[model samples]
Target: MERTILMADGQSFYASIEKAAHPECRGKPVAVGDPTRRSGIILAACPVAKERGVTTAERVGEALAKCPDLVVIRPRMQTYISVSLLITEIFESFTDQVEPYSIDEQFLDVTGSLALFGSAERIARLIQTRVQLSTGVCARVGIGPNKILAKMATDNFAKREPGGISELSRANIEEKLWPLPVHRMFMVAGRMTAHFARMGLHTIGDIARLELGEFKRRMRARMGRQSDIQAEYYWQTANGIDPSPVVSGMRSQIKIINHGRALKWQTYRTFADIEPLMLELLIEVCRRARRYGYMGRVVAVAAAETDGQRSSGFGRQMTLPRPTYLEHELSSVVRSLFLTHWKGLPLTHLHITLTDLSRDECYQLDLFEDRSRLIRREKTVDAIKERFGATAVIRASSLAPTAQAFERAVQIGGHFA
Candidate 1:
């Protein structure tokens, strides 16, 4: 009958990730940061570091003063980003209701479905367990009647227990909420705290003592009342009320069905290096065309020329003697097209686009040329790549001097020497 929001917070997420990947750091105090001589500030601290008095965003010097033996590690963005995506996939497996609150925090609505798994407490514990199993990191979860309460409940549990779960409901609001610090009121961050202090309202109980409207009138007029919205949020949380939904109603973006490569090299050394690149670009264009059941009839290239002049490569509509997903056949067309168009010009950036697509690929055979046989052979090449891999099929034209010129270029950063 009541809705619940489950908040999953990876305890000291970044630091935990490093420690998880390397078991050698287990149980030792560790801080995630860029440990430079000048000042390596803390980004996140592990549970061990927290136990030793290190906290996030603290100066390296201050953190060291607080915890002398803190082991600070430089973060690898790539690894952390992958971990974030992996966690997101796990959340999606449970419910699309998963909404990421931050890199390590998420809210899931389990109101209607908590019973399918177990109680809200059970669900939270299960999520924490799975995160550990998959990521080698522990998580803390708060299960509450609303998002506000759920988040606070989770934070409350995390500070006191590791890999812990707690549930907050209207039934337990007063007994659980009242004794907490007056300053523990929800949504009362720095600005609201300063304003409340200025108005001599020192605690949640102090604000609760006044008329809601009067409380606003004394603080900062409209702004003070606005803070009440946040106050009301936490007040309701303390009362076991949450107005937020776990299920976020948002649409997923369509994956790129038609992929294209837009390339920019530092500089083009010769016509040799630029030509193979054209075939490389076209191969991608044709692959997307095949996936989407289309064939592009026009292929064109654009380049930045020497002397700061911009030159558009010659473009022509091409109909394969047969429709192909074959690298060799497409390579032949690309080579012929490049030779006809390029006149030994040095270039910087090159953009190749294949356009004028036909979704209906079946064409009537001309009496002058029977292209059907070529199409079937090309299709076989496509199958090899589909089964083996992208790099599985390379045309003989790939041997064209164009492919090797860049490798031989004496230029630094690919610029002409």
Candidate 2:
């Protein structure tokens, strides 16, 4: 049976949400970021800002230079997540095979639903209308025989065309997809684009036309043993063929959990100033890890120093003696990394990442430490916090002047409640 995949992408997601919430900013050039921080960059820009040459990730100062009247707003991540969940619920109403590509994009395998929905294009139109009416945000929908074409159709044509819907199939591959530059092709990064250029493969058509033997030979020189796999995948994608399934219920595939924060105030000058903040972040990270029933062996700490002009940061990773989800173990490593790597710089941000994960159910006892007692203690603390509130149970250090636990507990993604 031919697969029918649809990609639905929220247009200028963050900025659109802001505009929808604040109707007065509909046609104005608005950018979202930390308005209080002069060095903060534009996280998202509205269509009007885009028209004025303001782009996301550019510094607020630069965006202001491009459009003097641009309005900068702080990000409200919780609001965005809520809206995204609502959108996903809408997708779920159409098909059980909905896969979230990101917070703002999702792919739905509606092949089975085609019998009930009538046609792919009809379903796309219905979804687009439903999203706009229900969420007050417009969405672009792309329909194709497979995932790759569906995504490309949405990105390359649907987003730009009127009515915000586009369809790509084998019939239209030559006319609509071939002439596009190699860089525009999915998964083709700058370095790979240069490799394609070196091989005189300028467009997707060039790749599609290459003989299998010749493609593998060239790819082998660049990608080693993985050349055969990469060559075939690239060639198939160039011809608009994707056999990958639209996986559903994908929460089990997550391998890492990370939490980071940029300080609202630059009070961190030494280890003493930053230790409490690090401890708070570590507790949060471990709490999340335990909640997910996962434990990590590798823990990484990153710190950024704020100068007058730009911020510079360094990161270091260390493997734990055992895979455990205790806050004390992770905090010890974090403190040690901070002490050894930090040169008493003015700190502005801190990040903690947990990787090399395994299921917590499989955790073995460590001979050196009372692992069971520590786990029970932390789990009790988690229960207390969960039952009352995040700030209900707190450490004495968190009450110190340098700590931000009390302040952050009320926040959703670094913004004030």
For every candidate structure, what is the RMSD over all alpha carbons to the true structure, in angstroms? 10.5, 14.2
Q: Candidate 2 on 65-94: residue-level lDDT in tens?
A: 889888888899999989988998798788
Error of 2 at 338 (Å): 52
Runs off by more than 4 Å, candidate 1: 65-68, 198-200, 205-211, 220-242, 247-417
lDDT of 1 by residue, 77-169 (tens): 788778877887777666667777777788888766665777777777777778889987677888777788778777765546754777666
Q: Among these predicted structures, which one has the highest lDDT? A: 2
lDDT of 1 at 136: 77
Runs in model 2 deviating more than 4 A are: 222-226, 251-417
lDDT for each candidate structure: 0.65, 0.87
Show the lowest summed lDDT stretch of 10 residues, model 2.
408-417
User: What is the overall TM-score of model 2 with all chains considered together?
Assistant: 0.61
